[model samples]
Target: MLRIIFWKLGFEWAMLLRIIRPCSDQRVYYFAFGANLSPDILRLRRIGVYETFDHVLEDTVLNFSQRGFYKNHGFASADASVGDCVYGKMYLIRQSDAKRMDYFEGVPFLKAHAKIVQQVQGKPFYFYRSQIPLNGLKPTQQYLNYLTHAYRNMDIVPSQYTEALLATKVLKTLEPQDQTGVFVRHLSRWPKILHPSLKHYEKHCHQLVEALWNRSLVGWMIRV
Candidate 1:
């Protein structure tokens, strides 16, 4: 049946991606400003941290503009803004761990694989930015809680910065009949058939975005 063929194709594609995916053995500095800021969350994600430091990304402002898988909520994104800065912790992690992070971040799908680099204490640090950003989205309380815990745990200087994060507006409750959740739940029932199709769809989307992102005009528009 066509379903079986697609499933096989999808499985093979996934394997190919894993094989071709570039992974570095060396370590790199990753700047965390979102949920990854929480030590507990980082551990849960299985990213081994070698060291941590208080850092700031200059000429940027933290915004909840990145669309999340969960409807009605947004994830943290650092937008370019003159004379502004986003404070967070810098984590030194293995390159393999960074690849793991890409999976969780929905890289090449929800988020682009493009690295947003900035000078932190005279060294280059990397961070992520959403592939497509929308304005005026608020984070959920649960997401904010992770950030709250992180800010408390790390000694981010200029206490007011963390205070601003705490003050960010949050969606206190998710809808009882969250349609996305329902759809995902139903879709999970037939992973064997659906998984491949879903992966292909993600791959197609990533290719499309990458094409547009490579266009200078389109890329500039996306940043602004």
Candidate 2:
């Protein structure tokens, strides 16, 4: 009964709201995409994490989400139809919590680096992104590898502010190819990669997979 109730509450309502450290972590910041606009999400975030402003990067985008850039890569010219924006979430978690988020994102696919961007409230904050842009991610080879790893490791019940951002419709609608579809395709094809603990998220995982395959799923689309 408790498990069912907990699932109903969702991660933002559960861990994020209840898990935040007291006195505010100061290092943490909130980045909302869409669903996060719900008062419940914000209230929960306030409870689970610290809020902060002041950072190195200025927010160039006016909308809710921020971009995680890879410095060395030229703009992706091959896919013109591809959406101009790539979507991601960012938060200034302590190095300790950062490690856990990293595992969920698969640091191997997403290389963390220091970056600054504006939050929903127009405040500057720090975060990271995938290194492949600078390192040259082979879409053909790396895509499969990344998708595989992400499926196995990605935490559907996201704990970070960015996770909420990625799932938002804003990013999904703008993607050139179906972003979520591509994401789930890789995960479904690969099994035995998921950790044992994620058994709890299995239903959510199947839902994502089905959503991706059906092409009927709904979410945000980025504009650029």
Candidate 3:
């Protein structure tokens, strides 16, 4: 319940910032990799996003093969040497909504960093890209530990409210294990390959990480 409250508050607070414009163009473009992929999730959240640019995370593959909502759908792996570019669907969101997306993704939750992109129409704009980081995996480790114990005795699916509670439990459980440095160091060994397709793998990786993190935690905390 606390997590849900936090998410609601977070969205409300972020929506307040939407009044301020990041670009004069009003509409902002973003690359969504997670719940945005699931129409059901969007309907649940009441977030209105429509496809604008059809994209794919060209070089990357699914990082977590299980426990995520979307993994059952067949997808390719992101290369260690060259990350895979998985297919992604793009949306033109209101600048206000775009800011909310950033707020939800940054820090405590998933981090979606902005990248400069040139659209098919030759318009230069910013889009959010997600990845493990140039230094290496992040939030993933903290996320992993939290998930390990949080879901140890729970059902695979639970009520939405219970799922939210699990999110909090996972975060609290992992706070003591903040090993950011180690994860970043590990990245040095990961393949730093790029894909040729217009798609960017980092964005997809971010979405995948976020979805898996939330769902896995939720699945582990609830009673079937």
Candidate 4:
């Protein structure tokens, strides 16, 4: 009888626990290889950014592939490249922020999420592998500025990576003009404060990197 009563009590405890904690507030670790790496864009727009770190994505290469998020054409995308590493930022963010990032990355339309993007800390790190068809797409200099700025600011990126980025050949198409200059100026502005928000400041510092790392950007730059 004591064993039977104990079993019942344990079952009830388990049920109660589930009822009280329907779900745990789980955070997500996300990696960014493109303009999303800009902290200004992540914070002012994407809330719930918890923390971040500079990381190098292994066995992958970065490039401007497919049309941009706005229509800037051929935005930054990544593909598997043997014997190469890509520089990027890893973020610890709210799960909701990760979902919103899906929208930003056009996950619903792109069908890119098959599995966790890559492994980190012995776990999967969700990411977007942008390998859209590349055909005569070119990124604006303003978009380019964001990337170069990021590199200039962050010493994490190797000199050769910056050189390879600047060396990428383009078809020299009638380069699409954009107001990215104003947007870049806005994101680069430093806040006047004694103790800036770390996450916010981290974002600022991230975007503060020289523009050479930025080869493409969101399509909405047309509206900037």
Candidate 5:
């Protein structure tokens, strides 16, 4: 009966623990493809990132979302499209720090939504993308400068990112989505077996695999 209820709720018992435990020694990896790539901006914003790295998430495209950028007349937010690849920085942050960063990025709020986790190497890395609702709008000079500056500094400029950005254009829309996210909107068909509930456990189910890796009996293989 307990298992049936958990299954019907489409979550595991572990979700309750996740709600209660906001702090953990296990830090998570976050990919920042947008303005958050700037270390100076990150510090100024005081996002509390534990450590940062330059990384390229393969097979994802980048484009602008959101209608405005701060005080600028037209500012676009960086969002990922499904097809191409995007270059950006990765931040290793604690659970608490991650929360602050997400809030600043409008996670679960604004046009941008919560992080959609992807894997790098072998661990989990959440991605944050912005959704822009207006069309024919361009980014302000200052906004472009921030992105270009960060790209050059991060070695992303020499790559195809700049050219790709030059080609991508915004589309016009009558109504804007409140916070319809990149990953969440399409997650209606996600694997039912992997959701979180109040007392469930597959995220922790792997015992022999991890133990084998630790004992040199097996190696860590990255699926992605």
Candidate 6:
């Protein structure tokens, strides 16, 4: 019951903010990888894209090292490596949208903002990196489907890279240790109640992290 109430409150609060939030004219370049590479996902997330270009990050490799919302799989993160490259779309988006993205990415917590300056243009473009990197992880097949869909639908990324991603191993089933996965799996028992409960729990976690970063002295120091 409390979860449902919190979920309702959070949903209402988000809607209110969207109604009153001022749009910023300032724009910045953002590098998209993993699930973010999908235009459909971007649209669903309500991230506006002014323009997009196929860009490559030199000396960086894509890896599934970031623990995902579900314990059974991991999410993509860019890791620095010699003689490696990560190819993806660079989007020009409003600065306001970028801040909104910070919440979704769990910035200053699960992930952190990172940038690379282009040698040719001398402009910095931003990307997200995992705060903690773990090895020997695989992404879920459903997550990989988003990347493959983007690769096929966008026709921007190289074919070889797409094939490489397709060849990557995926987790076939959720591990018993995956708490969120287990919660979701049992949703069929009471979807109307459990679904909102899960959503509220996620919203509360995000709020807690955001509040800690905004109010703590350590967070201030880190921001500085």
- Best TM-score among the predictions, by candidate number: 6
2 versus 6: better lDDT goes to: 6
lDDT at residue 218 of model 2 (Cα atoms): 15
Candidate number with the higher TM-score (2 or 4): 4
Instruction: Report RMSD for candidate 4.
Output: 19.1
lDDT of 4 by residue, 1-224 (tens): 23223433443333344334323376778887767777677653333556788888888777676454232456666667898777878887655456545544444433323224667998668777653445455666655655666766667998877776766554445432232321223533646452234334433332332221122232222111
Q: Give TM-scores for every candidate, taking all chains together and pairing residue i with residue i.
A: 0.64, 0.25, 0.40, 0.59, 0.54, 0.66
Candidate 5, residues 77-194: lDDT per residue as tens digits?
A: 3455566567778888666556545545544323344467888879898876554444445564545556666777776546566755655443333222222122233334556553
lDDT of each: 0.61, 0.30, 0.39, 0.53, 0.50, 0.63
Give Cα distance to truth, residue 71, candidate 3, Å: 18
RMSD of each: 12.1, 15.8, 15.5, 19.1, 15.4, 10.7
Please report the TM-score between candidate 4 and the true structure. Answer: 0.59
Q: Which stretches of candidate 2 lie over 4 Å from their true place?
A: 1-26, 44-124, 127-224
Error of 3 at 51 (Å): 4.3
lDDT of 6 by residue, 65-159 (tens): 87654444678888888998877788887766666566556552243334343532566678877666668778988888887777766565678
> Model 3 over residues 1-224: C-alpha lDDT tens digits?
23334544565555544443334356766654433545454444334554465554444442322122121221112223355443345677666556555544542333223343545456444444433333222233343333333333334323452354344322122222222221133433555552211123333443445543323211222111
Write the number of the candidate with greater TM-score, choosing between 4 and 5. 4
Task: Tell me the number of clashing residue pairs for each predicted model.
Answer: 0, 13, 26, 22, 15, 0
- How well is each residue in 1-224 modelled by candidate 2, as lDDT tens digits? 23323333332222232234322344455332222223343342232333332222233221311122111111111111223332223344443333333222223222222233345446454334323222222223222232233333434323453343334332212222212221233444556566332433543443443333212111111010
Q: lDDT score, residue 173, model 1? A: 59
